[model samples]
Target chain A: MQIVREQDVVPFRNRVKEFATKIGMSLVNQTKLITAASELVRNMLKYANGGKILLEIISKNAQTGVRLTFIDEGPGITDIKQAMQDGFSTGKSLGLGLPGAKRLVNEFDLKSKPGEGTTVTVTHWKNGR
Target chain B: MDRIPILKMGQFLLVTIQVDLYDRLALNLENDLINMVSKTGARGVLIDISAVSIVDSFMGRILGNIASMSRIMDAETVVVGMQPAVAITLVELGLTLQGVYTALDVEKGMELLHDKIGTIEHPEDEEEEAPHDDID
Candidate 1:
């Protein structure tokens, strides 16, 4: 668990980089996860109080990948389902936040409760090798 | 660094965009770059990344968008002066850029400009996106 903020993005990205490196994560995949995490963490700081993110390596039967869980105790999403749409956003972006991140990672799961907290999980694996 | 000004030779306009291009700024810069390519009347654009420590996934997305919009705008976007460290970092970051022309320096950028320079018209319009307050 780590507090989230704009300044924390660097550390979060670095954390992902360190973990991703040990996992032999591909360059493209690593960048995607880092970028996605950075954006989410930024949101956590901008919209919520500090949040914590957990980065871990997961290995399944004959397969290995990285798992990142970002949790924020901020005002939760107004709509979980609509937030997944590309053009839907409560922020000033092109509404590419959640959906764009989804395009980059293998598994994406998110839950949010208004006035409570928000959590997003994304996992990236090697090329099915 | 002082902002690089857009230059005009005959009808062709060559503009330079050199931002650190990191973090979330990378994504917005990409969108701006793409829109500049599509809507601007310029014939050629030279993007210098020497100041950038690295180009990441967000930057990669922008580069792809620029290439796609270049075709739509009937213009050529040449990427210039990517530092070795930046290139390495970009590779390590696993970023990918497609359909972009690259040059080593302004001279080389000019050389690439020679082909499309003659097709340039007046600087027809500026970007339409809401200006990012941080970028000046």
Candidate 2:
């Protein structure tokens, strides 16, 4: 899904919720996943001027998880570590988007190059460990 | 431009959010509600969010901002009917919504608002009123 404007955020969230529900994710887990997706989608729109999101469902053994990858080609983060820290924001926000998103998912990965772009991938397991 | 309606009931303003709020709509609500409070001189604000399914940090901040703004305007804000899942997600998102009041439902929220403003008349007290008081 391409998230290029503020209006796109809601549809992106609905898509994420649909995917999470398809996997029979618990309400709590689904909410967490969707909230994390909302934060990332808004971040992309805020700092990166919008981006594309990829959703996938993966399973291993008896556990199923939903994974989302947000790819943005706008301004990238120079210091990913600082971006992941709480109370750090370049925008006029509460500075909880990145770190808060990380806490909601089971796995979080971020890659950014100052001139290239930024990509964030988050995964939430059905029955979280 | 879609807008959320803010109902004025006596000294209180009521907002029932029945749709999934996009960022823009949420911001607009924050703006409109604050303006309404100031315009009407409302003493309390009640937001019923039972239909809302998810709340991220931005939305959470918006709610907190509304509470803070209303506080400065001398109006108490109560967020009612938060879904259990949304509440859990909010905490995980590191948004405790401090300084905001919350209740389980709209009725309870209305009661809380009345209690906060000291306007609720007991049922027994109403029953004890003399019949001559109804002449007006």
User: Best candidate per TM-score, number?
Assistant: 2
DockQ (Cα-based) per candidate?
0.07, 0.75
lDDT of each structure? 0.66, 0.92
| TM-score of each predicted structure versus truth | 0.59, 0.93
Docking class of 2: medium
Q: What's model 2's lDDT at A110? A: 96
- Poorest stretch of ten by lDDT in candidate 1 chain B: B119-128
lDDT of 1 by residue, B5-104 (tens): 5555543445455544334555555555555555556667676665643354445657666766765777677888876645654543344455788889
Best by lDDT: 2
